[model samples]
Target: MALRANRVRLGIFFVLIMGIFITGIFWVAGGFSSPVTTSYACYFGWSVGGLNVGSTVEYNGVPVGSVSAIEIAPDGRLVKVVLNLEDDKFRVDDTIVASLFFTGITGLQDINLESLPDSVERLWSEDQLTFESDMPVVPVRSGTVQSVASGLNAVFQSMAQVDMKELNDQTIRALTRMNDLLDSVENDSVAVRLSRTIDNFDAVLVTYNDLGNELTAAIRDAREDAEPIVEDLKEFTGELDNLSEQLNMMGADLHNTFNVTNSILQEIRELLPNVNRLLDGFSGGYRGEEIWQ
Candidate 1:
C-alpha cells in the first residue's frame, strides 16, 4: 500500500511537470492565450526571399505582432502576408503604411509600419481594415531588388525614346562647320587681308593726327594776323570821326559866305538907280532944265 501510494505521487508529479512544459511551449508558439488581436494583410509584388511566417511586425520600431500566415493570393502574382497584432486599440488609418525591412546579417525580412503625411488622410477608408477586408489592397514597397529593377526599367525606357542618330548627325555637322571656319582662318589670303586692313587703319590714324596739327597751326596764325587788322580798323574809325567834325565846320562857313554875297548884290541894285538920277541932275545944270529932264 505504501509503495503504491509513493508510485502514484511520483506519477502525479511527473504529469504536472510535463503539463507546465507543454503549456510553456504552446505560449511561445503563439497558441496558449487568446488575446483580442487584429489581423492585417500586406502584399509585396517583389519576391519575399527573406520573409516567412512568425516573422515580427513592428510599428515605428515597437513590436506589435508576428506574421500569422504567408501565402500567394488567388492570382499568384504577389506574396501576401497576414499579421496578427497583439494590440488592437491603436488607430491605423492611411496615415500609417507598411513596408518590407531586413533584419541583421542573416537577411531576414519583416514588415514595418510607418506613418504617412496628412495629404492622403481622406483617402483612407472609414472602416478599419482587417485580413478579411475585400477592398482594394494598398501597395507595399520592398527594398533593394525592387527599387534597383524599377530604376533600371525607367532608365531603359528613357533611353529608348532618345534620337541617337539625329544627335550624332548634328554633332558631325557642327564639327564640319568648325573645321571649315578654322581652315578659312588659316588661309593665306584671309591673313593678308586682315594685315592690310590693320595697315589701312594705322595710316588713317596718322593722317587724322597730321590734319589735327595743321588745323591747330592754321587757327593760331589766323588769330595772330587778325589782331593787327583789328587794331588798324580801330585807328581808321577814329580818323573818320575827326574828318566828319571838320566837314561840319566847313559847311557852316560856306553858309555864312553865301548870306554876305546876297547882301552886297542888293546894295548895288539900289545904288545904280540913285547914280542915274544924279547924272540927270548934272546934265540939267550944265545944259538947262530940258537937258536935266
Candidate 2:
C-alpha cells in the first residue's frame, strides 16, 4: 500500500511539473500576460513586396510593434496593413507616417514609422475611406526601394513606347548621306581647291602688308619735307610782327610834326595883322606933314 501511495505521489508531482512547463511555454508565446497594444491602419499606394503578416514594425529603427494583417482595400487600388504597436511607445498624429523598407540584404521588408514635420499636410486617399476600421490611419510613403522600382518602371515603359526600328533607319540614312558627301568631296578635289584658296588669301595678306609699309614710309618722308616749310612760315610771322611795331612808331612821329606846324601858322597870322596897322599909321603921318609944308 505504501508503494502505491508513493507511485501516486510521483504521478501527481509529474503532472504538476508538466503543467508548469506548459504554462512557461504559453507565457513565452505571449498567450498569457499579453502587452497592451494599439491598432493602426496603414495604406500603401505601391506594391508591398516581401511584407507579410507578423513582420516587424519599427519606429526610427527600433522595433515597436508588428504587422497584424495585410489586405487590399475594397477599391483594389491600395494595400492596407494593420499594425499592432505597444501602447504608449509612441504617439500617432497627422505628422506620423509609415513606410516599407527592406530589413537587410535578405529582401525581407518591414514597416517603419517615422515622424513628419508639423508643417507637412496630411495626405488622404479615396482608398483610405473604404477601410471600416476605426483605427487611426497612418499614411504610407515610398521608400528607397519603391522609388527606385518606380523609376525603373517608368524607364521600361518609355523604352517600350519608342520606335526603335524607325530610329535605326533614320540613323542609317544619315550615315549614308554623310558618306556620300565625303565621296563627292573626294571626287571633286575639294581639298586641293581649299588649299589653293588658303594660299591666295595668304598672298593677299602679304600684299596688303607691303602696301601698308609703303604708305607708312611715304607719310614719314612727307612729314620730314614739311618741317623746313613750317620753320620758314614761323620766321615770316615774326618779321610781320616787327614791321607792325615799326609802323606804329612812324605814325606817332607824324602826329607830333603836324602839331608843331599848326602852332607856327597861328603866330604868323597875328604878326601880319600888326604890320597892316603900322603901315596905315605911317601913311596918315606923311599926309599931315605935306599939309604943314
Candidate 3:
C-alpha cells in the first residue's frame, strides 16, 4: 500500500513539471513581453489628462510602452510625462501631445499620445518632460450640441407668448365688410335702375329706325313726280327751236327794206337843187311882160 501511494505522488509531480515547461516554451517562442528602452517627453503646457505612472501607452492602436513618471516644473507651469516603449518607437525632435479620449459614452478615458511638428530639441532636454492643454485642441462636440438646444428652447418660448386674438379680430372685421358690400350690390332698386336705362336706349333706337324709313319713302315719291315734268320740258324745247328759225328770217327781210329807203333819199337830194334854179328864172320873166302890156 505505501508503494502504491509513492507511485501516485511521483506521477503528480511529473505532470506539474511538464505543465510549467510547456508554458515557458510557449512564452519564449511567442516573444511576449519584449521590452525596448525608448524615452518620450510631454511638452510644456500640455497634459496627459488622468494618466498616472505605469499607465499603458499605445502607438497607432497597438501597445508599445508604459508611462514611467509624471512631474511638474518648479515654476508650476510645465508638466511632463515620460514613457518607456518596448517596440523600438521613439519621438522625433518635435513636440508631442498627450490627451484623454473616451472610446464611448461610458466616461472611461484612455491616454492618447500624438506628436506635433515643432522643435522639441529647443524646449526639452533628453529624457526630460513637459505638458500643455492646447496641445492638440480637442473640439467640444457636447458644448456645441448644448448651444443648439438652448437656441431652440428660446425660439419656442417666444412663439408661445404671441397673441392670436388681434389677428382673428382683424380677419372677422374684413369678412363683415366684404359681406356688406355684396349685400348693397344685390339690392332690387339698383337692378331696376339698370333695367330702365336699357329700355330707354331700346326706345331711342326704334325712333331712329322709323325716321330713316320716312326719309327713304319721301325721296322715292319726289323722284317719281319730277320724272314726268322733265319729259314735258324736253318737248317744249323742240317747239322753241322752230320759233327761233322763223324770227331769224323776218329779221333778214327788215334789213333789206331799210337799205332801199336809204337809196331813194339820196336821189331826191340831187333833184331838189336843179328844180329850185328853174323856178327862180320863170318868176323874173313874167314880171317884165306885165310892164309892156
Candidate 4:
C-alpha cells in the first residue's frame, strides 16, 4: 500500500509539472496575458465590410492591437467593434478619429486611428473611458466609398442647381437671333451692298497709296529742280562778294589820290603866296591862275 501511494504521488507531481510547462508555452505564444489592455468601442455609422474577428488595429499605420469582439446594437442600426490595444500609453481624445481603412486589395478592413489635419479636435491624455457611461465610440469612415459619394454628391448638387429649361430657352433664342442675322446677310441686296462697300474701301486705299507715291515723286522732282537754282544762287553770292571787294579797293585808291591832291594844292597855295610877292614883281598868284586858265 505504501509503494502504491508513492507512485500516485509521483504521477500527480509530473502532471502538475506538465501543466505548468503547457501554461508557459501558451503564455509565450500570446494565448494569455497578465498585462493590462485598453478597450474601446467603435460604433460604425456606416457599413462594416471585410472586417472579422482579429482585424488589425493601427494607430497612424502602426500595428498596436487588434479587434477583440464584434456585436450589433439592440436597434440593429450600428455595429460596435471592441478594440484591444496592448500597452498603449496615449489616450484617445477628440483629435484622434478612428476610421475603417484598407490593408490592401485583399478587402481586409483595419481600424485606423489618426489625428485630424484641421486640428479642430483637442488632444487630451487624461480623458478616460468610463465603464458606466456609453462606451467611447468612434464612427467608422468609408475611405473610398465616402470620397466617391462626396464627389457624386457635389456633381448632383451642381446639376440640380442649373435651370436646364431656361438655359435651353436662352440658347434657342440666341440661335434664332443668329439665324436672323445670317438670313439678313444672305439677302442679295445686302450681298451687293457689302461688295460695293468693299470695292469702295479698296478704291480709297488705292487712291491714298497712289497719292502717297505721287507726293513722294513730286517732292523728289522739286528737290531735283531746286538743285541748279541753289548752285546758281551760291555762284551769284560769290560774285557779289567779289564785286564788293573790288569796290572797296577802288574806294581806298580814290581816297589816297584825294589826300595826295589836297596836300599838293596846299603846297601850291603857299608857293602862290610866295610867287605873288614875286609875281607882284612878276604877275601875282591870281594873275598866274588866270594865265594858266
TM-score of 4: 0.47
- Regions of model 1 farther than 4 Å from truth: 1-35, 88-90, 118-139, 142-144, 179-293
What is the lDDT of every predicted structure here? 0.60, 0.67, 0.50, 0.60
- Model 1 TM-score is 0.45
Query: Candidate 4 residues 96-212, lDDT tens each?
Result: 667777778998888888767543332112242222325556533445654455555545555565555765665565556545554544344444544555565565566556555
Question: Which stretches in model 3 have alpha-carbon errors above 4 Å?
Answer: 5-9, 29-34, 44-49, 87-98, 106-108, 115-293
Q: In model 4, what lDDT does residue 1 have? A: 100
- Greater-TM-score candidate between 2 and 3: 2
Q: Give the clashing residue pairs of candidate 1, or none.
A: 284-292
* Per-candidate count of clashing residue pairs (backbone under 3 Å): 1, 0, 13, 2
Write down the TM-score for model 2: 0.47
Model 3, CA-based lDDT: 0.50
lDDT of 3 by residue, 47-135 (tens): 33555688776644666677777787444765556667664564433344444455456544445555544432223333332333323
Residues 1-293 of candidate 1 have per-residue lDDT tens digits of: 99999999999999999999999999898895677877776765566788889998888788888888888765565567787876564445656667778888898988887776755222113242324444334345435555555555545555555555764565565556546554544344444544655565565566556555655665567766766555555655655565565556545545644554455455556445544543443332111111112
lDDT per residue, candidate 2, 186-240, as tens digits?
Answer: 3435445445545655655665565556556655677668665555556546655
- For the record, the alpha-carbon RMSD of candidate 2 to the native fold, in angstroms, is 46.4
lDDT of 4: 0.60
